[model samples]
Target chain A: MAMYVVGHKIPDSDSICGALAIAYLKNQIGEEAIPTRLGDVSPETQFILDKFGFTAPELKMSYAGEEVYIVDHTEKTQAPDDIDEATVVGVVDHHKLGDLTTSTPLECWIRPVGCSNTIVKMMYDFYNVDIPPAYAGIMMCAILSDTVIFKSPTCTTADIKCVEALAEIAGIEDYKALGMEMFKVKSAVQGTPTRDLVMRDFKDFDMHGNLVGIGQLEVIDLSVFDEIKADLAADIIKLKEEGKRHSVMLLLTDIMKEGSLMLIASDNETIIADAYGVTVENNEVWLDGVLSRKKQVVPPLQDGFANA
Target chain B: MAMYVVGHKIPDSDSICGALAIAYLKNQIGEEAIPTRLGDVSPETQFILDKFGFTAPELKMSYAGEEVYIVDHTEKTQAPDDIDEATVVGVVDHHKLGDLTTSTPLECWIRPVGCSNTIVKMMYDFYNVDIPPAYAGIMMCAILSDTVIFKSPTCTTADIKCVEALAEIAGIEDYKALGMEMFKVKSAVQGTPTRDLVMRDFKDFDMHGNLVGIGQLEVIDLSVFDEIKADLAADIIKLKEEGKRHSVMLLLTDIMKEGSLMLIASDNETIIADAYGVTVENNEVWLDGVLSRKKQVVPPLQDGFANA
Candidate 1:
């Protein structure tokens, strides 16, 4: 049977590229695997795929009775809805270990790094399989996107080294220029729907019995979002009601400014206020020098809900 | 602060040697680590360590404020009593993913091989660190013990290849002879107490809200346990009552005959009887070709209880 390689929902560049690269590696090692995604590709990811000469992965929402190899994330909330019916054969991730359990022994390769593509690069080296140049190009772009162009605090030396090596393999002389070009595509929000922007990188987390939805939108400049912050906040309120979530937040992150403007829509704002030790005004707050959500935003919210 | 490298309770050869080898590798990579154990070293493990000129690791039962790297097991039932209070920085194992969650990104290396020592050997290769002769000898012995000298169904080609590589490093030409020697040490039960024999290699599992304790003793001849079978049953009953467990079982496995004589002491015999589809007689039943407690035993019982 062909195994499916997949990543979390609200697929980001790293998740999509990691799935594609891992499926390619597994096939090279004599296993038939197909890359899959839980959601639609965002504009940034679409740009990288077109630039690197690759198509988006097949959209697969359910995995009943199928075999899968999970990548990028381990949380049950981020998995397919019927994931309990599928068998997880392996996992390659770069996050805190979440509440995912497997019945049989599995191949798990998890590490503390900025990007899942770094671990995928390590897997290629482990198997001594040469990656094709196009795969290397997308993987490099994934690292650059995930680490916010090496500005996120989660960026480690291993991630930096992997991006450089991947760039060399892809025959790209100026990878930084390529990263800036990709972020420029990400910052385009002129005609896109507000709800689409809010759901661009959204995920639901079960924090102490409360379901919280968090999203991020990275751009080169913060001024572009000054016109639609009210619309984003209203859309988040609708999202919270529809999903029956305790809170919904969207982060408008300016990569060049190295900060995030957080828009909050919640049942009670005290949780977020007390968690970050900041007061919220007008349903929004400016978080200085906060770029990485996995490292900076989620942990304190988890702690806050846990204590509450 | 020095990180502690430890294994699960009931310190078997694989668990003990894996802790030592991983701690050594971490130290070689410039991290300060100390090997620790949750229980006393069994006679078979002691023999292997003494032969390899290494001492037993320090006994540590709690890890309240310390950082740890778990080996051999991932289940919460097998972890330290205060595992929730400690920080798990990494895990290296060859078992099913268990219910252990961490709040921080960790280094996890889990594979579906026969033994944890095989994974440790791969880790040694991963870091390009040379293994000491003593470590190699003990690691080879651990592989032999866990895989039952390649007779176990769980033994894979990777495990055999690792043992061969480790044996060459340990300067052992006839590794099979050394394996037989280790089993001989494991088969000795003339003067050992019934409780000690039962707890030699025991672990507890949560089977659908029922805590089940299972132990295994591998020997060359099953007849050696004929005289103490009744005493072993009584001890298991006592263990079940004392620990408030739903059931306790002991497998007297004859390695040469390639079968096991399972003794059951349970709150309800139908659970085990229906699991393996066998009719129990006098609290014991002979199982043909059941050398692996992990591959052949646990999965069926877990499924049986889940269905029941």
Candidate 2:
């Protein structure tokens, strides 16, 4: 049976590159698998794909009645639209286990690392398959993006070790320069569409039957948020209305400052206020020392929804 | 910080032996960890411990405000009483992810292998730690018990490979003899108390807010169940009443016939009848080709409960 290897919706650099890397490794071990994407690639992911001389994976909106292997995520909502109908053969992820259930037992490799590519790199080593330099380059870029060049709090020693080893394999001598190049593309928000900006790295969650969506963008400066604050808030409202999410948030993460300015658009403003324990002023609030979305953004929203 | 390595409640041989083996490997790697059990040990696990010259781990009823690394199972109901209050450092398991949520990110190694001990055995190889003969013997017994001597449908190639390697390490030339030796101890029901017989290898699950408990025993002969059928039913009712379980079941698995005679005590008998499409005959029914509790028994029961 043909197997589709895909990442989560609103594909980030790590999910896109990690899916490709795992597909490559699986095919090397005599499996019939091909890389696919659940959503359009972000600019940073597109830039990395171009730099590594690889084409973007074909977009797969659904996998009904087919075999698929998920990478970078295990959440059913973030997976392909018809994930419940598909036969999930395997999963390689680096996130909290969401409400994804499989009818049959399958291989799953989940680790608490910074990037899903870190787990894929270990899989290559375990299978004794030599990773191609292009795959290594993209994998390295994914690690850099997900870990925010080792500045994110989720960065671990294993992530650092894998970054160094993968960098060596990719013949990357100046890791900082490569990371900055990727970040330059990530922060190029001038003239970008407001909807694209809000949907770049979006993730949807089901918190006690409430649909919550959070979008994040990391940049070296916070002035970009000041320039597009109103438009971003409008886009958030539009997205929330269209998707019927209980809350839609956009996190303007200042990587250099290790803080985020969160813009919220929801029917219930008290949920946001109670979530972060801060007044929602002008539909926005500054959150100091909020770097990791999985750790910082999601849990409190869940708690707030629970309380509400 | 002291790390208490623990297994799930209703500790089977795989869980009990896997916890001890992981604690041994962790301590060898310059970490302070001690194996602990959430519930009393079974006679089969006790037999393996005795054969390996090891003592049963101290009972750890709660892990309130402590650091812990869990093994064998990851379901919150199977975990310690105060798992939500504990800081989970890591997890090494082989079961489906349940409702166990950690406050912070932690290392989790979950695979699709049949036995948790198979994953622990791989860790020994990964860390380059030579397994002691005693640990190897116990690990072998764990694999044998969990996989039902490679008869259960959950048995994978990894489990078979680990069983063979562990058997070699334990210097056992005849794996069948060793497996039968273990099963003989498991099926010894004569003169045993009714509660002990049913509680030997029991597991409790919260199926959509319903407290469901299943107790299983693998026997070479079916006559043993005929002798204790009435008492087994009585004990199931008593345990369900005392434990406040919504439903309690006893699976008398005849390994020789590769089927199970299920005795169920529940407020709703139609759920079981609808789950397997078999009529409930005097509080029991014969289930042909039902070898795995996880793959066969639990999933259908869960579906039945959901429908109910």
> Could you tell me the lDDT of residue A234 within candidate 2?
89
Q: What's the i-RMS of each model?
A: 0.9, 2.9
lDDT of 2 at B165: 94
- What lDDT does the true structure give each of the candidates? 0.93, 0.86
lDDT of 1 by residue, B95-158 (tens): 8888888767899999999999999998999899999988999999999999999999989999
Candidate with top DockQ is 1
Among these predictions, the greatest lDDT belongs to: 1
| Candidate 1 C-alpha lDDT tens digits along A14-93 | 88999999999999999999999999999999999999999999999989899999998889999998887788999999
Q: Which regions of candidate 1 fall more than 4 Å away from where they truly are?
A: none
In candidate 2 the C-alpha lDDT for residue B137 amounts to 93
Error of 1 at A8 (Å): 0.8
Per the 3 Å backbone cut-off, how many clashing residue pairs does candidate 2 have? 0
Candidate 1's displacement at residue B265, Å, is: 2.5
